[model samples]
Target: MAHLHCLPPSVEPRVSEHMPQIIDMIKQIIDSGCAYSIDGDVYFSVDKFSKYGRLSGRKLEDNRAGERVAVDSRKKNPADFALWKSAKEGEPFWGSPWGPGRPGWHIECSAMSATYLGYSFDIHGGGMDLIFPHHENEIAQSCTACENSNVSYWIHNGFVTIDSEKMSKSLGNFFTIRQVVDLYHPLALRLFLIGTHYRSPINYSDVQLEKASDRVFYVYQTLHDCEVLLSLHNNVNRKDSIPPDVKSCINKFNDEVLVSMLDDLHTPVALSALSEPLKIINDLLHTRKGKKQELRIESLAALEKTIKNLLFILGLMPTSYSEVLQQLREKALKRAKLTEDQVLQKIEERTTARMNKEYEKSDAVRKDLAAVGIALMDSPGGTSWRPAVPLAMQEQQVVAV
Candidate 1:
């Protein structure tokens, strides 16, 4: 699954591995008089932390009236949170000076992060729901235990909704990443996942996935065509400068895409910025029409390299160009309900009909193939077939009509 998603270093830190450090931090907070113990359990005193609600923007008083928080009279403040939970029968235990108990959920993260990433980190991210008590408590615990320990950015991403409803197992609307990729290419799922701003809620639907799949096909299809053109023009001796418009397109991609990504990880805008460069390349590839001079081979190579680098950064098109195009063609064939052998047979029959001067039969065959979404192109080299509708685009048009 990690390979499929192209994730990097997906390692989980076990709280049990840092039990002593957690116990020490808890002791440090208690000795600082910011926390207290009753019987065997330890709870942090929220009243001691003057900036307690700074992260969540909710005062302790606000939480005091909130129904979601569980109030315990044993704590000094109603907003006080547990740091160490005393062991119960049949429960996991780690020996501490206070008693045999385990670290609380928030404390576990604090201790593990401090032990691994030290007192501070650049970005701390989680779901929007965690902005409240969970993250708020982590900040409170970390600040009290370690000096200058703080997150530079508290990045919280929005949830995925199914047709405007929150997806849940009990609701029976939940879909796993594996299930999603099973139906669509992993890149399509990746594109759908990042199609919106990270902080904005994303709605999941088959239509959206199909559209993303189609976009992926179009992107790779363009890349494949660019590769073919560049292969013919990959000579360094041509030594022609990049055309003005093409250079402008590349500059815009570099400026817009990179700047958007750097500005708070605005990937949606960055992905949208890709369209300008792609359109420019497509126009150039189709013909040198508008320009007085054609673009040199080096210029095409540069454009191809620029786009490939951008796609690499987005974790798309990891395979060789030919391999990706082959996969896309196979997918397109399945969508058109046609196999390679069937397509080949039709092409052969059309060739035979053309050779016999059976123009009507050949034309009829072409029309039939077109109806099934197959496009046949005859060339000096031979005959080749590609799906007439680029999958998603065709489906979208049909729906529109």
Candidate 2:
């Protein structure tokens, strides 16, 4: 999780230690006439809360009444869910006025949030599956206990699915971070997750992961190219002389990126916004299409800085671009079953073939390397190779789809 840059919790609140708060919360709802106790278990009466189904957008009558009746006959309403569950044989019990019982799962969440953040707080977040019963019950519990709540926003992101089915542990379908990161780069996973809108379900597949990894490599490669070009012209101080078109492009990119982020954290569009600027930078670096050399270099420099700032906001590149590139290359080499020396040996062979004007042999060598998941990129500096997803694996994905 830390590899993904998620912050560590400041304090870990356990349900056992917060029994007092849970008991108090249960008492508040009971006193407000929204809950009732039968034997040892207490249930929150769904009929008592007028706004009970607001969060879930589910009507009380929409329940499985025609399908099957709830097994618990003691409850006043079938919709009423437990605030506390009576102790079963040999189970842990807590001291409560309603007898020795533990807090219900729903009530536990309400108590924890209300205890630390107070009955009124800014936000409450959970998955879409928790909308019904869980968050709905929480709303009923909190508001009935305190009359009002300021849980200003409710953000529910869509689930990650495996082969179009929701990935869940209970369903025996899920992937762990450790399992994935062992194969692909961690940021590739991060990129894959955020590539879609938060409200849209993202399909998890090898093809999807490979696509994300490729994009990550492209971004880092662009950054590396920028670094190389900028270093060569470090003495070129012509920021003020940047062409109007280039400045306009950078300004437009800045606006679009921020606007996309602000529009409900739409990261897909934000990520897409990087493409144009990156293309402009690459064009300036490689080709001088109808522009002064100095002006083109200056424009390239400006665009690179703008992109770096954009990357800063996105938390994409946390370290030197070359280091990340090397990490990807090293991982790629291992996957390709080739060492750096072996890659160098191939490169040397290709160089000799080309020097001797042996085109067929050079092409053969390139093809052989590519067959083992390597791509050779020829530049003025020389030829270099990086790990690439094999065409055979990608073809299998197309057939699967």
Candidate 3:
């Protein structure tokens, strides 16, 4: 979670720590006649739970009639699943009324969840695939153990794919977070992850990640520019009243972003809402008309404050934007197999070539720098170099702030 920049859970109840609770719940289910013991093994009767397949919207008969899974002879019904398994050699065991046994996979989740979050939690989330046997069984087991197992909302996120194909180790498409961050910025991957709606299938590709990195860089650059421009002004006090246009934009942000967030965590829509305000901020910063306006400093200040708050709320802001850019630059340098000294040497060569009217050599130097993921932007002030991610799909790849 830390690697992904997510906060630790409020309660970290280990399943092993809650073994007694798990055992009690299993015994309670058995006592309620929802589960049965046979040859030291316990199985939950799906028929006893009338809402067996409710969570998954699956019919019991349809599940039983499925052709793929062969019926276990030990089970009372085809849909019946294990609650506990008898102790096996070279495995850990817990003492139970049904003799030495271990709890099944689904029971541990229900037990820990009920122990910490309680029987009636607000939201229970997992992958969409868990909706079937895993979650369905959890619902049955939890509700059976406690009469008021009111899990208000059950949310499931879609799976991630690699290059539009299902990610599988066997297919040589599996990637670890550490491996990915070693190549690109962790926030780049984070941005790519949240770029789409939670319920939508996200395709992971180098190109998409490059685009996400660019978006992150653009926001940082904008923020840094705002910081510079705002620093030039001595009056840093908050304005009594912002421009009507700025006020309207902020109100719209609350309406579009915060409200959508409340309405089922519509992150994609919330992210999209930022685009307009960010463009407005950039316009105010860059254009002469915006600079000449009376409310220029005030508007920029308001925007800077608002944007930073929004990014923090969304868990998108870095502790230091400069640090993020630095890391990206370091990674880009390594990726290009170039060091700081080597890059400086190349830049000096390029500058000298340009100064001596060696146009061909200067052009070649520019190509060499670009090949190493470095873009040179020559402004009236000076020539500046930054790590450059590919600008393919330029139209689609907007700086979605």
Candidate achieving the largest TM-score: 3
Q: lDDT of each model, Cα atoms only? A: 0.77, 0.81, 0.82
**lDDT tens digits, residue span 63-131, model 2:** 764245445889898778899999988989898998997999888888888878887877677788888
Instruction: Give residue 119's lDDT in candidate 1 (0 to 100).
Output: 77
- Candidate 1, residue 9: lDDT: 50
Q: Write the per-residue lDDT of candidate 1 for residues 1-401, one digit (tens) a residue.
A: 55255667546887778898898899878987899999889999989989998988997777653377657778877778889989999999988888898888889888888888887999888999999889999998889997688899989999888888877788899888877765566777777777788898888777676667667766777878878866675454666578787788788888987898888888888788778777766766765562234654556677777888877887775567567556656765765678889989989999999999999999988877776556788878999986455433455522110
Lowest summed lDDT window (length 10), candidate 2: 392-401
Q: Report the Cα lDDT for candidate 3.
A: 0.82
Please give the distance, in angstroms, between residue 174's alpha carbon in candidate 2 and its true position after superposition: 2.9
List the candidate numbers ranked by TM-score, top first: 3, 2, 1
Candidate 2 Cα misplacement greater than 4 A, ranges = 65-70, 170-172, 231-238, 290-294, 352-361, 393-401
Off by over 4 Å in 1: 1-5, 288-292, 331-401
Local lDDT at 77 for model 1: 75
The RMSD of every model to the true structure, in order and in angstroms, is 4.1, 3.2, 2.4
Residue-level lDDT tens digits of model 3 in 17-52: 777998899999998899999999889999999988
> Residue 385 in candidate 3 has what lDDT?
79
Which regions in candidate 3 have their CA more than 4 angstroms from the true location? 64-70, 234-238, 391-401
Clashing residue pairs for model 2: none
TM-score list, all predictions: 0.85, 0.90, 0.92
Residue-level lDDT for 268 in candidate 3: 72
lDDT order of candidates, best first?
3, 2, 1
